[model samples]
Target: MAKRISQDQIAKELGVSQSLVSLVLNGRREGVAEESYKMIWAAALKQGYVPRGGMHPMHAPDVQHSYVGVVMRAGLALAAQSNTFSHVSHGLFTALQHLNISLAFLGGEGDLDETKLFEVVSRRDPLLGIVILGEVKEPFMQALGELELKLVSVYASSPGLCHSIVPNDKQSVEQLVDHLVALGHTRFAWLGGNAKLGRNRLRLAALKERLAARDLLLDDRYVVNAEGAERQDGFDCAAELMRRAEGQNMPTAWVCHNGLIARGGLQFAYLRGIKVPGEISIAAVDRTRACTEIHPYLTSAASDPELIGAEAAKLLRSQPEEIGQWNKMFIDLVAPSLFEAGETSATRPE
Candidate 1:
């Protein structure tokens, strides 16, 4: 067999410093010129060299030639089928397609079980990485850390496990506050179940902080953080808010936690003969497209799900090169595209 080319040989041949060659080979050319990056890419492809492990057992198939992998998740990537599902998973899938990574679904045992989920990716070697799309628990995430499998998380984030792709709730929440406030709506009701879930709690806290900054309070009576964001939670929460008329006996607005909750809030308002935006304007954090299906579409400060999928996928793909490197590239904020004019805005109700 012919002698293999070393990094030194490639550096010498390219007439560039080793660091520059390394950066180009590893696809980190932030400051470097595009031409040099392309030159290294072309040479590396031609030489059949992958900056990622080339001969290690953990090494995946040549992404340059052919790479195959599966998209394992605790639940089906239903966002692909219907916008009714979480848009987050769809974001991860979209990213995979762009990366040219073959994506497949291997649904787990349904409880966010780690072993079953990992098994889905355990097979099909030469897989670039596995994108576990949603509802995975921390234990399972920890296990993935041990597998040396390149991984990306869409709905959740963990430091020791893998790369993550999440939406920017801060901006989304703050923008929502601004939008609602602009409509001349001051008295607000937040209807959603409360839980110990980290992300959900973050949303609630963010809402409180955002509102407080404007001298607004969530008014505990209007906010039902007792139940989770389940459909029943939404319905009950809405029902409770109306029953008590907590803030002003006749509140001017309602802001829900999500589309599902909005559905419940809408239903509660309609059956009770309250006209949306007429008697009580409503808005919430809705990313899924289901909001439009409702007669009076919900106004949501929603994040883009497709972008979330792609960013997560991109991060997962980077895990291999970044294995020995301690630094992590966290992508928790997929810029959201909030829509205010979508069928659910009007001057604060009389």
Candidate 2:
């Protein structure tokens, strides 16, 4: 039970105004350095301090507890079944406890009814609003409206309904490509492209634009569209692509859509006895369950699943008036944090 640190401490430490500290702390700070805001976020996450709903931005309070409802997208549950899920959930729950908020997980196939979900959330003692952890279905959004919950969208936003916290898509992809390009990788292959949902599509599109700017465009032969939601499909897609790669010629590197596909690609390459990087460098855009818990941890875009949870919490507490002010609130987390080059990447063979 750590004593709650005030926003004033953050403001003083950063030599910024209390207002700005509150803004950045509450996930609303714009026009500030990304690294600087992360410094504040690190402190809050460390201290486990979630600001209470309807609390004045600058005032510190002494109430010991509160609660928020969280509606996670369906895919996260399946992914969470991974070994990394426990680690990520622990991080998020630890932060929530420090803030005195007990999370009530709602909105999955088990109990996805917006109407029923809201009924349960409303029954929670001292409930404020709900946090939509991933994609929001009409039912979930409708349920929030039924409860009159101050809804928060964790990743994507619905303009006037809630605030959002997502990775900087174009910027993150551009930075990743820039890093790989700097490594002398010109020819590239991708595992998951052509999805119109969520951020991967945005990342993939930006990857295209950025690479083309460098006079490096992926030929039709270098792309793989994995259209299903299973690891086997990922493996099959990567295997199929490798077959294609053999037919066309030598590509310098392969950047999968996310780490799952990256894992699949790695396995596919390993099975084929194609020494990664020694043969084809492997990388991915998103960082979850991709590079960890395996030999030669993946090289990928850094992602904090807990951040997704945390952002959802923030959006839940924000008021409608505040929501209108939110035009794509995002947390830019891309510093090219490469973990364990892992023999997956190396210099191009002459």
Candidate 3:
């Protein structure tokens, strides 16, 4: 094994005190000047000073050394199973590879709390930037903003904090509404509008606006706010609405928040002996691999996870000064497409 590098050596190289170098390497940033913190990390990385028993951040075993950190909402096992997360990862990795910057995966929700996460990024490695995969708590996000690293978020945004890349909800809502309206459907209902996520809230608001533009109204009784954005949440919402609509007129068409929720709507249909597209039509706002996992493929609007990921990576690759200019946030929007040929939706019943 090659000989280890020391804080003494790094401090000497940078003309800084060994004590200051030690403090910065240990992730301390309270009183130390920002310039000194940056310098200490730069010198440590340049001199190949890996912490004892810790893998070198730039020269870890089996993979190229990394300078970019990827923080996800869930662990890799769960994320890999999600089409949206997987596609986003694929796009991010591809772009990072092209830029010749290796990626360091920070622990997910189960592995670390916000405090631990903050410590790791500030101390563990000389990471110059970070790529957040999905929504995070505002306090945690604000904490991250205080770090001296470039930050980019995929699927979410925080003004004055970091650049964000997200799908075009307005265009997506238009496609879904237009397709269903063209099919002769008049009465409509919304399913699985989880209010916790900003994107979900945005979609719901856009749906109402789109319906209003066409001189249609989404009945307050038919709009179900999901408890969570899971398939089971979709099923529960559908069941409640179905029960309430007994001996009453049910909406001829339903718009779901996501493919999983749409699948749950289908499940409720299966359980209740309802004929899809013949008795009622079901569609979703976002497309995913889940759309085709069941008997009849779900028709939905498609967001480009890959494009969002790539754009976020591109933002992080640019200089911090270039990204953080004029107090203007970068809200990059990628337009969505429609999967209108699926069997879930059809012309309104006579």
Candidate 4:
């Protein structure tokens, strides 16, 4: 009988680790760099090394890889915050239970380096799909795209790269504007986050469009963007806005990027002896209990994170078995509903 062709032989021949050869042979290529992946596979083919189970799915008949992996783009600290991603995860967990599909959390960005990501993927059965909880950079996304696995992103979109489920910013902003206008408040200020992010940009733009339609101008001085995404950034930006609007027309209503920043704004109000909804009304685009941690709960126009997660789960589960069978990229947009307007948002101050 001919000697068995083991992973060790292929690894030694290609000047790579036996573990790496094993990972590639097991069909976990999501974290492997494209060039390295091709080289390892080409080497395996040249050496006529076949996996103990069978050939690669791309080369052999399709196998049912039922497992799905979830990767959080944010590090552990940021992900821990009760934000959209966390709620989406709750929905994903609940929906996946009925789908009868197993779920695996690969790790957050900080937890999984290249080798660790590959190791995690290898340890599991071949994954059918991956659910990305937040926005990822181009290079990171490119590596995932190279994998033959399907991808679904929650609260973000990668355009033609993968399917996405996101909140409808335009509709949500419209609802918020309608409410503020009904309160007889025309002037508005945006306490926002980094503009480089598409989500932030979309929210800001939607606010501008809605305000313009209502014949209200969002003056440049009133739009203060936080230097960072933390609570302190919100406080600093709010102070800056107050200074800039000093002796000038100030916006009566304020809209924040998310509950975290919104909470920060409320703190600034307390420190400055400014009463929320009494002196200036505050609202958020995303909801979190932290917004309510203060006296008045935050009013928000936001989608249900659980619903978004559930929708993402369905989308991932509906993916075709064969990677080649995927259709044009799918995008599902869920609209936001107003919550607790009476608590934080009030009639415009005279």
Best by TM-score: 4
Candidate 1, 1-350: lDDT as tens digits: 65666666667778888788887767796999998887876665456454445555444464442243444444354444333234555555566655555555545425445656545444434566666655566666666666666666665566655666666776777777788888887877777544655656767788889889999777777766545565667778888877787455666767777777777777777788878778777777767766777567778876677767666666666644554442344444355656655566688855
lDDT of 2 by residue, 230-336 (tens): 45556876887867877666677777766677777777777888787787777766556555657677666644655655545555555557644333342322222
Determine the C-alpha RMSD for candidate 4 after optimal superposition of all C-alphas.
7.0
Error of 4 at 24 (Å): 15
Local accuracy by lDDT, each model: 0.65, 0.63, 0.76, 0.76
Residues 26-48, candidate 4: write the lDDT tens digits: 78888887887888876775565
Sequence-dependent TM-score of model 1: 0.70
Per-residue accuracy of model 3 over 282-325 as CA lDDT, tens digit each:
98876667777766988787677776777777787776477555
**Model 4 weakest lDDT span, ten residues long:** 56-65
What TM-score do all the candidates reach, one by one? Answer: 0.70, 0.70, 0.76, 0.77
* Residue pairs whose backbone atoms clash in candidate 4: none
lDDT score, candidate 2, position 124: 25
Misplaced by over 4 Å in model 4 are 1-66, 74-79, 100-102, 109-120, 291-295, 319-324, 332-342
